[model samples]
Target: MAHIPAHSDPARQGAPTTSSRYELLTLGDELLLGLTANAHLTWIGAQLGRRGVQLQRNVTVTDEADAIAAQFRESWARADVVITTGGLGPTCDDRTREVLAAVLGQKLVFDPRTEEAIRARFAKFQRVPTANNLKQAYRFERGEVLPNANGTAPGLWVEQEGKLLIMLPGPPNELQPMFTEQVIPRLAARGKLSDQEAYIQIRSIGIGESALETMFECTFSRSPGLGIAFCAHQGQVDCRISSPDGRYGMEKLRAIASECAALLGDNLLCFGHDSIAQVVADQLKQQGRTLAVAEASTGGMLANAFADLCGACKFFQGGIVSTSNEAKMLMLECPECLLKQHGAVSPECAVAMASGVAEKLGADYGLAITGFSGPCTGGGENPLGSIYIGLHSPHGDWAKQLTYPGPRAAVKQRAINDAIDWLRREVLKETHRIAAPQVN
Candidate 1:
């Protein structure tokens, strides 16, 4: 893995570089409790990444004035621009205005424009504005008020003490549009017009991080102006390539990455940003086939993965989650005799589940996942992480056994990915076999 690009290399050596990069500070007590999500920072960072600006550091603080001021000071000291979301409301806990005033040696004065807007909003809701709501109009020295399309609380943009500060409301509906329309263009104008780095990610499965790293160690080390990163999980790996060449950019980078992946052979799964489910969905589209799923131990995850794919309704015929033996027999029409004899975790049971789903749904193919995804025992005292995935086609039904090593949730997730990968491979193989010459 490579370090964050902005932090590793200084834009210019020694001299003070012009205002270019930014630091994001998200303020809310909910973030600390893991209740309120911090989506603004991620959204802004992604947007900035598309441009040339880089977000150096991110800090999350409660609505406390002291904590917000301390973080604001620290962030601005390192970054030329600072962006904050949350704590802009008129509630007693909202202290963003006071903190910004303290940091910039200014006082918050009531603005008539903000006050009228707040009052109008409350009137539309058939309510009277409270005294606390008057704080919404507070503004700092020479600060510009950015309109909020979706909310009453306006965003603030201030430049002082050789640093740029921007504050927006917490709600995504307000934050996203305001940041795009009001903040981004201003930042671009203030910063230098440097060529942006291109980013490309190659998603793969059934390959370990160490092996993937070794496969490209030499190539990445020698590749000029390219940054490569590998993110590994239980069932998947992502190879991220970022190059600092604006011209021919991602196109050129993707071509090189495809060549590197080809070197790794079949270990390379999907190209670009497609997940395993997305890749499988693409295969179904190409073959003009629809798929249905029968999930057991993996719950509905296998089916849910396909449903989450974009335009899934085009080829996914839905699925059934036979969580219990009764559901399997009743809903999916799995043979009660087979379940009693072979057990639900057995490959035979998985085969029946897949075939039953395919026949019932009238889909071209069906995928089923069954096994012990827990601390429970399976056939012949087989320990946890024992899983079976079956694929049923018009020709026949076949199942594959997988033994993954991880926690209960990890095991289930791994099984789901493995099941999808198996179906993907089968689709490729079946297509190739059908296209092959028959030696009659």
Candidate 2:
């Protein structure tokens, strides 16, 4: 529960003197005009953070050369490292290389090696390089070239007056690998990276970020050098507990993680980056059980969630998307009486669908979802965002009604998450009970 300083806080900025402070400058009119999201910020920040490098500030500028130069100058003066993405393509609007060269007080020099590499790459694809594509062969004087294995534009690594500037391509496919292979190793060799921090992430469902924060504050004592951060998705929250202080060892962090796991108990989905579906798949495999799913409004999303996991065929039986009442009755063997009386989106119909699918597929468990995720809803009783999740396990069969306020896609995703979490919790309980010693 220790207070963690925000990234923008001047105090935190001043305190990270040992860690190399990096700033990102994203170029492109698409980003500035909101035509494209600046995804580089998140990806680069995460990569750097994992390596214990602090990415301080991010600035986005249009394709204008002056604006790019101005932002680069400002970022270079403030941060020890400045990384730019975009504007490295073959088009005339791609102005990152020239602008950065001018700002860094270096001339743009064409390298025959780079032009040969580009032409070779084009020849490999049975194509010829265009005149503008050769523009990517230009390098800043006294700068080292970072070869791009994925694209035509080779990245640049330049240093002027002790500050480093790394320019990468805009496409994620090209930028990510180059940064990982080229940028990180160079930084590490130069002793510019800090020691990796110790951290644990606990993903949870059926809990709001605020509520989790309050619970942690009330139950857990504030310990020195411990920091907590929460990231909330549509239906889940990831709680990250870190020991940012280099002096603290993993033992303390593990102890705190254990306490947190015990506190969260049923609400906790899984640790680290494991998805809920993956956890459920593991549980089913451990229990030697199989599952089938029936979906109405969520289409095949609920089924895809499980089927997407590796080796899912061992535990995932099959899925049916029963969009129509007739399909529900014919395919899932849902009773006509239940659908007629309580409507298709009701708990009764949902439960019937679950039971029918389990019986039809001869699986150990059945999960079903019928929802009104839409801009339109059934007139009187059932409104938009109304959802019913049904689960049929070897132990019991039940259904729950949930309401999520959002657009169609958001509502569908939330409903799918809820259904998956419900199934996960039920399977978890069954597994625990089976593992427990019998009380004769």
Candidate 3:
């Protein structure tokens, strides 16, 4: 067995200030072949970042025994902690366990406790365990088993000398909970975790990445120990500001955040991980208002965005996917004359649909989307990717037209984001008005 000592400092005590280097090895033919995304890398990286540790590298390999063993040895030699996901099932392609055991010169010991747990889990489904299922019950000769409440494949935790290896199942549901509950606590208890970095995320809409970068560059050009990164999505951008050194503190980060917020202005959605839909929902709930949506070219995606949030039922009354002209006229009571005169993709139709749905559903706010997200145009003056968003609120009715250049799916996503941002701004206006002091 190749023994590698864990990295340690004799002069340090109680949670060291230095961050632990974590390397992740994801094993699956699907990932290496690009048939499946390596979501584990992103998710694990984020979790470790929250704990003030950074994932240094992530290597994805096929389900080959030699390849798996080689990568494990390489990662173990480099990182203080190494974690692997996938290839832990009962199938023939599952090679992580046997490969790692051979590499570590440890025997594969059959654990009766693990077998019993696996049997109990199978019994719950009223199914008998197959012979091959016993493969999961085997553990390392000198290691502890990490129980999996959600699956039959129990995880493994093995250590030699000072280095550690943690193996988890591939299914996200199984992996997420085990990593959170079992892996994190073990690492923390060993004084491997630290809170030495400060991070803040600011989400914004209706802004280009280059524009945001240019705006922030001149202001913070001389600021030392400050780092800014931008992640752009379909219609949103996330600005992450970090100070890796603990000496900077959150006060400096907050002060910098306030400056960024001032520059963002109305373009800023909110801080942290709150999405635009969540922010809109929060505002509506605060105002005791309900919203109904009528979507055309965007289908029901706008509604799905809101419905995905927790407690959406409180503010999201309902939504209608009025794709065809007849459906709009029948379900939302959109004026037939408006559709005929202005066509389905028009500001007139959008406004009518918004007002109609709000009246039909008895909601405080109504949002409508009418667009031509197409390879073909609307067969008139209207070109492809023309979107009209309409809003009918207690205050009044309003509409705006936007042109996006992209494929059908891209246009639809952009339109959905535009509608969400529009509603967010309108709700903010109302919130500000209500909070404003009287001048009497």
Candidate 4:
């Protein structure tokens, strides 16, 4: 796999010959102190990347003119383009106008056209313009003014000594539209558009990142253009494959995804960003089946996944949280003898709970999660992180024992995820065997 480092990537390189090289600098005190997130950087980077202008660095500076000037100068010398957001408003701390003028060695001049536009904008709103609003009309003589249709502050586009600089408004409503309509056309005219790179993420559950790396180690080396990365969260692994060909090189991307899926087999959850619940929801929708859940140590976590989904009432019948042995017997109709012989967290009790819930709710399928998610053990053959997930269907009822070492929150989540994935797999398997959605 070709994993291009940022320093070596042509898009990030500062070579004068590299057409798409760009750096982003955002100016604001709000961003510096985490008062607000720097949304401009993310939006600009994504937009520019699609147009072949890849951002090498993203910098945030306070509303000080010196700080803005220093970053602008650095980007001017180092990169082909520099795009900045914020510090262009009509406030005392809004210093981008003067900073740009200083950086370009030009005097700030009040433009008649800009003033006319700003005054016209205020006039339309039936509001008198403040003296500070006229400050928005000032522009450095070296740059082109891109009018903001949504606000008073106009965006600036500057080209000097082979370096490109653009200053957009701080507000997203104004900046986003201006950048897309006004700035992108200008950027496109500068040079050849960048060759697109594509990314495909195959998410899986019940798998470790390290184990996946080892499994795909040989494939990564053999696949010339495919770039593989594994990110582990909760109990799921997000295996991302990027290709130099826009969107993982099309056919190659699909082939690589298929190969990876085969490697992961039953563990593979689904493609793209769909969560386990979504995968199960889709499968249930296709199968035309209803599901009910009973959760013990997981509380209503297992049921909540389905509940949160849109139109969950169609397929999700009901749920019960049998946290205590008494509740397990009373609510879920779990046998007293079963709870006495095996604790609530045991496989036998888990299976009974699952089957019992299915019978109670009159649903086609039932899912149950029982676990010891805690710092202390809950008196069982299992330890602190041991869990038993049960699935009940007309054809079969079974339970599996799983153990994970983590804090209480993590163990509960993992156990719930295990139950969901197992049900999804079973549903998919049934789909393959029959034409219509059938249980057993």
TM-score of each: 0.80, 0.86, 0.90, 0.61
Against the unseen true structure, what C-alpha lDDT does each candidate score?
Answer: 0.79, 0.84, 0.84, 0.80
Model 2 per-residue lDDT tens digits across residues 1-440: 21122233222321232456789998888887888898999989877765556578999898999899888888888998989999988998999998888777789889999999999999999999989999999999899899999999999999878988999999999999999899989988888864453355678888899988887874346566567789999778988776566443445555666677677778877766678888889889988999999999998999999889999999999999999999999999888888888889899999999999999999999999997998677556778899999999999899999988878999999898889889988988887898789998
Candidate No. with top lDDT: 3
For residue 382, give model 2's deviation from the true position in Å.
1.0
Using TM-score as the measure, name the better of candidate 1 and candidate 4.
1
Residues 22-106, candidate 1: write the lDDT tens digits.
7889989999889977877778877775554557788899888889988888888887788899998888898898888888888
Candidate 1 vs candidate 2, TM-score winner:
2
lDDT of 4 by residue, 360-426 (tens): 9989899998888887775646888989999998679999999988789889888887788889888
Give residue 187's error in model 4 in angstroms.
11
RMSD, one per candidate, in order: 5.7, 5.1, 6.5, 7.9
Candidate 2: Cα lDDT at 372 = 90
Q: Which segments of candidate 4 are over 4 A away from where they belong?
A: 1-197, 217-222, 245-248, 435-440
Clashes of each: 0, 0, 1, 1
For model 4, give the 10-residue run with minimal summed lDDT: 1-10
How do the candidates rank by lDDT, highest first?
Answer: 3, 2, 4, 1
Residue pairs that clash (backbone atoms under 3 angstroms), model 3: 6-162
Per-residue lDDT of model 3, residues 1-440, tens digit only = 00111223332221215466789999999997889899999999888766657788999998999899889889888898999999889999999999998988999999999999999999999999999998999999999899999998999999886888899999999999999999989998998775433366777788999899887886667567666789999788988876654445555566666787789888888876677788889889989999999998987898899888899999998899989999998999888888888888888888998999899989999999998998667657668989999999989999899998979999998898888889888888898889899899
What's the true lDDT of residue 121 in model 2?
Answer: 96
